[model samples]
Target: MTRALLSAALLLLLLPGAPAQVSSQTSFTIVVSNSVTNAGNKTFSTFVSFRGILLGGMRRLQDKDSGFTFKYTEDDNYGPFLESVNGLAGCPNHRTYWELKVKKPDNKVILPDVGIGCYIPSAGDVVILNFNKY
Candidate 1:
């Protein structure tokens, strides 16, 4: 009985999709858009470690793609506030800011009630950053 139990444990360890064999790398897409619909849009493919923050994935993309760049300011109360994407900066006088939205694998759109620093992106999630006026 002990030999049979040991064989079962070995089989479990060799099977695909076992907890120990799970992948730590996850792939997601980032889309940048303008609410005004005139600035044009861009999409980037990025990946992060399991349960990693969206901001880290964004930084990874920026490092890989020269055309992609972003800037943010730390908020004491709110964490990181997205200030600019590409070369466009949000202007208070213009009443503009960047908005975070996501399209999940289910095709449903969601607005996370949190900042970039707090968002944990899932595999296959399509994160959209839109520059819009308040």
Candidate 2:
């Protein structure tokens, strides 16, 4: 096309994996601030879940709501994983665990919602999530 368009195309071709700033993820960790809490009639856990997509280790449900904060450590690979705290098999106090799932065009998946969270880790990459005990 024009000289300017040609130059732009050349520049784009020169760059490698321009879509991904760096490379595929290698390692990941989940930090749970608060796990569980008892309130009047309901016992609940605060959680943030996701895969591939980095999430917060700490997040406020609201500015005014008061909640407990707890922490946990996770050391797992980058595949399918479910991170969660034990709960009654059948309970209403338990909300459906929040989750984050990512499926590739190739039919591969990662992370989940419910417990603390999940990850598709990369080397030297850290994922943090914030939650309050309900």
Model 2 root mean square deviation, Cα atoms: 12.6
User: So what's the TM-score on candidate 1?
Assistant: 0.81
* Cα lDDT of model 1 by residue, 20-134, tens digit: 4546888999999999656778999998888879999999999999988999999999999999999888999989989999999999999998879989999899999999988
Worst 10 residues of 2 by lDDT: 82-91
How many times do residue backbones clash in model 2? 22
lDDT tens digits, residues 84-127, model 2? Answer: 32221212366433233333434455443443333333433323
Q: Best TM-score goes to which candidate?
A: 1
Q: What is the TM-score of each candidate against the true structure?
A: 0.81, 0.28
Worst 10 residues of 1 by lDDT: 15-24
Candidate 1 residues lying further than 4 Å off, grouped into runs, are 1-23
- Model 1's number of clashes is 0
